[model samples]
Target chain A: MAIRWIALRIIQEIIRDRRTMAFFLLVPIVVMTLIYYALLEDEKAKLGVVTRGVARFYEYPLVSVIEEDEDIEIVSLDIPDKETDPAELDRLIMEEMKKGKAHGILYMDQQLLSERFAGERGAIHIYLEGSRPTSTAAIFSSIAEAMDDLTETMPVVIDAECSAKCANSVNIKAIEIKKHYLYGSEDYRLIDYFLPVFPTFFVFFFTFIISTITFQRERVRGTLERLLIAPVSFSQIILGYISGFIIFSSVQALIIIGYILALIQISFTPHQLFALGVTLFLIMIVALTMGLLASFMAMNEFQAIQFIPLVILPQIFLSDMIWRIESFPLVFQWISYGLPLTHANIISRKVMLQNQSLWENWPQLLSLGGFFLFFMLVMSLVALKRNKNN
Target chain B: MLKIEGLTKRFGKLTAIDNLNLNIPEGLKFGLLGPNGSGKTTLLRMITGLIEPTHGKITLFGKWTPTSRMIRRRVGYMPQQTAVYPGLTVSENIRFFGRIYGLSGRPLEDRLNDILELVELGDKKKEVLSNLSGGMVRRVLLATALIHNPPLLILDEPTAGVDPVLRLKFWDWVDLLVKQGVSIIITTHHISEAERSDQVVFLREGKIIQQGKPFDIMKRFQANNLEAAFVRSTNLK
Candidate 1:
């Protein structure tokens, strides 16, 4: 009964604070929306084709074929016949790329054209402004598709003997590239691949911050001392707070999950969504307990916030969010395993994207439970010590 | 009733309470009088089990220590700081402490109303603590402590910032509690407030300089007021 009252009071206090409410509920939605647009929205890549000699005759057909792809835009650059310096042409292509007029440059010369007509394997030289990996990959795939189309529909202007000989020697579809997915489809964007991790991280991050600051404030304001003087035990206090924070954090989790799904327009099975919810709930408990333990070490609100770099930043960097944990060094991989977020990310990805059941991902789920227990145990010990000393 | 034997508390190199011994009888208004950092709060904290004594023992109502939950329920402590949550309504703050002491349903609500009336905050029970004035917030803290109706009440500077009118009302309320067989342990810097206590102890540098009935101490020092008596006992020219 005492625990229930304490939890109720905590809920009342937090609900009355408008700024904290906005930060807890609205900030994640706004941040996730920004990430969604930044990662998934693709713009058309412009390619500048420099054709010299006989290659100029292929430019119109090549551009027409590549332009069929919505993601690629082809621009034909005209150069005077006398200005045949390779360095000059290369400089011109580089200038176009630097000016942002083109994403890549395709150079097709006489030797490459004759080789193609002679039924020999020809090489196409392409220069790319390769700053962004996604854009670079997009440009390469579009050009590869355009080349495949060119081989299938050769220009009628080609000599009948050469065309017939080249067609007889080369199979039109020699390399049929087929795509098959074990889980997600070709329509899945980079953002969709990363979406499951965002809510897990936000739930953990915000809960930790709010719990730490609130616990620190309770200590500094002398309410904690008053509580100790009451009949309530330290464990009850910890449990009461956990129960209180869980109510709101659960709502926060639901908001983030619903908003992200609606914004990204992705559907999941009810069972998978339930599994994701369970993973996030466990993550919230771990975060809340960790924050309580941190508050035991902090004397004031500023000191509580100072723990962010020490506690939260490492989870962000090593939690397999930006880089896969398996790809990390052995030492870092071990550290990632120790963090609560790494387990949460792994479980969330498996359940949401891989269509895996919770039973199949029990190891990671068990690791999260372990982290929660460890944090709660340390927090109880610290609370006991603080009652005696402070 | 409370008894302390060789009670001592040290924070690293500084001894906040040193070899302190006192016996507080039941139903008496006991005042701990001291200047800043004189260990009055530390001694009260030890007696209330807010902190463990470095070396010694405390017996509360025949119990060996005051840390037991049953004993904790019988004692109420109001810290020097206004320790109420600013985001909660005044009624909510008082009711939370009441509920912690196992009061519930009609009993909790009745006690909540009684405490609010005693603190003269009945009309402002719905106001958030942060919206209240400093003195009103202190009253809310007092309400939370008094809401439990413990036999022994330990208040540290309960009327520090209260206006003169409400301060008198607080004394009246303390007098009423004592009259009802409640033992009150309080610390205050206000000399006049200390004069109302049945017994007062003057402490300096974590040691008791003088202790007895307020009138007896004044008489012994050949002084007209407890403040003058306290000054003479501390040897402050």
Candidate 2:
């Protein structure tokens, strides 16, 4: 009940606070929309299709049909005097691929379609830049889908025996891949990545910033002195603060979760909800420790403001939210290891993606639980030593 | 309800509060007086369990050493500095402090309104703390300190930036609090104001140079006021 009071206060602050509300609501939505539309823009990707004497091929009904057509630009390059300069054409396409001007390069041989091969399917070689995995995959998918219908009409030669698996007799070896998603496979956007971590992150970040300043304010305001002469104990005061912030952070999480679910189409598995709760619990404890530590380090509000960039930025970067942990060097890896966010991020992603139970992630759960206990102990000790006036 | 025995606090080799012995028997309005750097603040902080004394124990309500939560619930503190959250509204600041003290619902709302009216900022509750003048901020700070209605109130320079008229009004509230059995220990350099206390402890360079009722100390030191007694005790001519 005491904790509930503090949480309500936090909610009141958020509702009455215009600036904080803007940051929490408008900023993420604006950024997510920007990324979505930007990625959806057809002009972002360039494809160079080079075919020998195949200008007529573009008029085909199959070629007219394209995947996310507006999002991709298809540039057809005629193999200008292909017999006279075939190597030059390949060299030019490779250059375009290297410079990222073209995502993939396609080549078609006119001779393969002549004489005895007139009724047979001609080989059309496709070369992807391979520099960017996403663009390369997109180009491959577009061409594969187009050829699916065309291959059935064209008579193709077979050289090897047919088998249930690894059949090599067909002229065009078309492979189909079956994809199954655990969490979100249909819409793998930037916002989806944030959905798993932001609930806990905001709770941790806001709680730490608010609570740190609060304790210092108590000392500066003379409330600490008044409390000392009363019948109350120091532990009760600390608990009062802890309960207050826990309530504040919880309300924040609830609001964020409620908003995302109501306004956005993101869905979560039932098993993942426990991970979210536990992640929030661990993050709040981290906030509890950080708030206590910040109070000791700062004597004034100005000093506390400067602590934000130092405190917030590192946690965002090193937490493995934006990039893979393996991308960082060994030395920096050690620093990420020290951050509580790293573990929380990892655990959140695992639970959300795999729908794992609490018992399955006991190791991470134990580590986070240990961090909570350890940080709480450290904060209590720091609280014990702090002078009410300072 | 508060007892201090041989309280000593040191910052490295510099002793801030030296073997200070004091007692505030239940419901006494005590005043701590001192010059700058006289450890008046230090002594009060040690008693409140904000800072642990190096060589002594403070017993509150019969407990040998008070825990933070117990100490926090029983006392309301207003420090010397301007401590209100500048980013928050005047009402929000009071409400936050009230909530931390476990006050909520209709009771919390009533006390919040009452304290705001007491501070003469009932009309300015919507105003942000940053926009308020220094004097108004100090009043809000006091309002927050008194919100919990703790049995004990510790105020360090509660009237420092306050105007003379407002300062008198603040004392009126303090006196009312004492009448209701709220024991308060306050530290101030304003000697004239210290005269109103039931008991006064004068400190200089981390030591209590004189201790007595305001009238007795004034007469014993042969000084016109508590300020003069403090100056005379420090041999300041």
Candidate 3:
């Protein structure tokens, strides 16, 4: 019963400062927005199409063929005349590339029509701005698809027959490929892979900071000494702090995922939403208790800040957010598994990508349970030691 | 009443309190007098159950063991530093301290109003600790210490910043508490304040050098006053 009062008092102290409101709510909204927009880029790569002596070539069947690809959009840049210098055209295309107005240039030669009309080989220059990776890949694939449309459709003449009856021997088997996705559609963006882990990282990062500093401040200000003299027990103190952060972190996770759903239009099932919430709540509790343990290791707030590099930065580099956990070296992979954030990242990704049921996530839940028990035990012991010291 | 036996506390190579024993009776104001780094505060902390002695037996009200919840609830401690949370208002702090001692409902509210009035903070009850003046904060600290009305009050330098006139009224209040059978243990540097205590124990180097009433010690040392008597009792002379 007294735990509620303690937790409420702590939350009251934290929320009294306007900085908490801005940092916990506004800053997260802003960072999540950036994640959404950064992934929104390169959905369609614009290709600049330039040509000479091809006034009627735009009417060719390949124009509609290339435009049919959803990933590529062609922008026609008129050449001054059929005799216009190729250098001038190249300069115009380069200028467009520099301004990010186009991903690449597909320069059509007059031979494009003549070669097809004569049943001969035809060549066109595909100049790509190789510096832009995502857009460049999409543009390159679209150019390949445009070329295949003509090659794959042509009727093959067996033994180079010139007679109409010989054309009957030609085999033109219709080939169509169908693709099915397990998780998402064919047009998956980088943000789809990235958004799953963003909430976990954000919750871990900010909650780690707040919990460490809040507990450290209590020690530095001598309030913990006062509290020890009260009837409150060691476990109650640790439990009180965790409860307070649970309230804040739960709200933070909901707001982040809710904002993503509203603005970025990421659909989520109720089960997936619960999974994300549970993932966040478990990690936040771990961070909160770790912060409590860190308070004993630090004498003041500055010392607590010093812990960020040793305690927080390692989780970022090694916690399987940017790369696969198995991709790490053997020893580092072991270390990643040891850290609680790794499990949190996995649980969140499973929830987001696979919509995995909460009941199926028992292994990760057990790991978190172990972590909670360990941190709670250590934190209680240290707090008792501190009470004695004070 | 409290009795401490063979109490010793050592921090690594240095011993802060060594083999000290004393008996404190009910309704007595015992003054622990010592210089800095002496064992006065350490003794108070052990008695209040905030820290454990390296080797000791403490008997409180016929109970053999210390650091029990009953003992903690019965003993109120006000440390030298300003211990109130700066974010909480004065009334909030009072109610919190009251609740920790299991005070609730009308009893908590009544005690809250009374402590606020006694601390002369009736108008500032709604004010946060951060916005209060230093003297006001000190008043609030004392109010928190007195809220639970514990049987034993352990005050460490409670009158450091208060003016002389308020200090007199503070002692009058202490006298009232003593009359009500509440044992008061205070540590003060001021010799004049030490004279008001029914018993005085001068400690140095984690051991008591002298223990008696101020008048008895003064007469034993052939000194004119308590201050001169303390100087004559110590090795400084």
Pick by DockQ: which candidate is best? 1
- The 10-residue segment of model 3 chain B with minimum total lDDT is B228-237
Clashes of each: 0, 37, 0
lDDT by residue (tens digit), candidate 3, A279-357 = 8888888887777777677756755775655566557656767654443446766887788888888788667765668
Error of 1 at B172 (Å): 1.4
1 against 3, candidate with superior DockQ: 1
List, residue by residue over A196-286, the lDDT tens digit for candidate 1.
8889999999999998998889888989888887898887888898899988998999999998888653579999899999998999989
| Prediction 2 TM-score vs. true | 0.61
Q: Per-residue lDDT tens digits of candidate 1, residues B1-237?
A: 798899888888898888999998898999999998899988988888878888999999999989899899999888889898999999999988898899999989998988888788999999998899998998888888888789999989988878998888788989988997889999998876788899999988898889999999999999999988988888852
lDDT per model vs. reference: 0.80, 0.70, 0.75
Can you give the lDDT of residue A377 in candidate 3? 87
Model 2, C-alpha of B206: deviation from truth (Å): 1.5
- Candidate 1, residue B42: Cα displacement in angstroms equals 0.8
Candidate 1 yields a Cα-based lDDT of: 0.80
lDDT string, candidate 2, B8-109, tens digits:
889888899888787778777799888779898777777666667889889888888665566668778888877667889999989988877778999999
Ranking of all candidate structures by their DockQ, best first: 1, 3, 2
For each candidate, what's the DockQ? 0.50, 0.22, 0.35
Give TM-score values for chain A, per-prediction: 0.58, 0.55, 0.57
